[model samples]
Target: MSQNGLRFTLDVDGLTPAATAVARFTLYQNLSTPFLLTVDIASDRSGLTAVSFLEKNATLTLWQGNTPLRYLHGIITGMETGENNHWQMNYSLTISPPLWRCGLRQNFRIFQQQDIRAISTTLLTENGVTDWVPSFYEAHPPREFCVQYGETDLAFLTRLWAEEGIFFFDWFHPTGPDQKLVLCDDVAGVSTLGSLPFNPNTREVSTECISELHYRAQVRPSSVENQDYTFKTPGWPGYFSHHATNLNGQRTQYEIFDYPGRFKDEQHGQDFARYLAEGFRHDAETAACASNSPKLWPGKRFTLTGHPSLTLNREWQVTGSVLKGEQPQAQHGHRGEGTTLSNRLDVIPADRTWRSSPLP
Candidate 1:
């Protein structure tokens, strides 16, 4: 008869109080990517008249408690209308961070004499995200590379950060009501991380069947086809070349990236070369599982039990997660019964060197 914990609040830029039609909204949270809120309004559309007031930089917020958790503010991108019947009107709005818009724009021009951190910080600031912060595992010095012309910002970020073993994500502040940007790195004993003090023992699993777990791994041992290789900097002529070695077998594919700048000397080349060699230390792994109990986050480790094979079970670190919850049809505008937070997480083997340090 009541929807106690399934309530949410939506605050638009100009709106005095955040808005939410209790039984009409569903929230979706994914790793690193922004959270999504889908609001369906039936019949009268007077409540959402503010949709016309939304502008490009307008902010849209989704929250549960006075304090935000696993949820943050999203920017208004679009809206649509649907007709369930002549008298019933259906309206929907899409909200997410400005990243979705800015990420799509092509790089205006090539950058010069800039480091990776510099570029990343600039991009973050320019997109209206002034509070960009990196965890300690991200201590590596700014890397130098020549970016090509006409590339999208998101593409550049994915390519550059991947090589450096870093990722981009957003999380709400523990103390404040704002979403903070995290430039994370996958380094063991170097980045900030904390243990889950709440459930010290193995958390309950949502899916009991052993078939619920999925795993895939690709590894290539050191071999001729997978050996190291070198590439000369485009404009530098014979002065410098970046070399990268594959710790696995011969590579079936290869790519040569040109950052926006040039290496000042051979030492720079050597450092980049070492980066190339160590970049692929971990095998490409894909695994996922569903859980209705323990909530998961990206870059954190968890354990699994009851796998038929020993090799298939152990401590696994989460790489991504999708948190979902649903309730029965509305009773006086409230969802009931099914709102306990259903979640699915993608995980990988916890390689020692890839674990993050204690969290701040």
Candidate 2:
């Protein structure tokens, strides 16, 4: 294996390479967003004729020690190939989850008396997505009517999820390329990873650890005030507001106000108000870290240790990550050449609940 004890194998349409043959790869992952995996490979011939890989299934398996640590499964959505030299051909491929196809088509549709969960499930099912789980704690009252309105399935679904404060992330399987889509509205649904030490001096540590970390905080509104009108109760305009606790610092009193909050009654208005308030404060505080740990993916929690600031040594949840790996040119044909795994992670306090901001 490589110096970082990381290796990977890429299988495209049942055609597994003898070695990973991967020169470089970048995996972009984030909560509420579909992942994109791009990998460059050195092959013996052009993939265009050897294999009809486009739109075919693909999986990238990451290995640590003798065990598989992570699996990225998706469809080969894009590809480019060219001759690198007389001995080998170079190609690159883009892999994305089946859910990504939802954005490829737009339509107009309507539903009556359905909740967000039920509506979203239907959209996912219609797009041929079957492996998904719901982790919601709040009640989703059925709406009288819902409309897709000439938007892509992803666009419509995103709007619905944002309104209900629900988001999703993928969970990689340990043994195969099968990943699960976990839809969550609460932090309890987030998975956790054991603690890792913060060792700034990368050369001094042998085990997987964070080499660099930084804490950040920004000002955001502490409360949300909203009002809506309904024909059934024309005389009474629905009004509701929600506030965050202990955000009494500088500029923290700033308030957000909205008219016609898109709800019919006071109960729904209150819920939307809370969702808006939480959405505003979602990124008020965050942490940025770089690590060699392959387990630090979005929608997962981890604890930090050995930090100069004691307050930084606490539980945090990853909100997004950029994972990069590369192998030296000399080891291209090896079964498992070493891959230098470096990752940049965006995280927030584990105690804070995550909410997707309303899309404009």
Point to the candidate with the largest lDDT: 2
Cα-based lDDT at residue 307, candidate 1: 65
- TM-score of model 1 (CA atoms): 0.65
For all predictions, the C-alpha RMSD in Å is 7.3, 2.6
True-structure lDDT of candidate 1: 0.49
lDDT of 2 by residue, 184-247 (tens): 9888889888789898877667677877788988888889999988788789868899988646
Q: 302 in model 1: Cα distance from truth in Å?
A: 2.8
| Reference-based lDDT, each prediction | 0.49, 0.81
Off by over 4 Å in 2: 1-5, 18-20, 47-51, 246-248, 330-338
Candidate 2, which ten residues in sequence have the lowest lDDT sum? 330-339
What's model 2's lDDT at 265? 60
Task: Estimate, for each residue in 196-232, the C-alpha lDDT of model 1 and write its tens digit.
Answer: 2222122343232222567875653221111222364
Model 1 bad stretches (over 4 Å): 1-9, 14-19, 22-44, 47-69, 84-89, 136-145, 174-176, 189-212, 219-283, 305-313, 328-340, 352-360
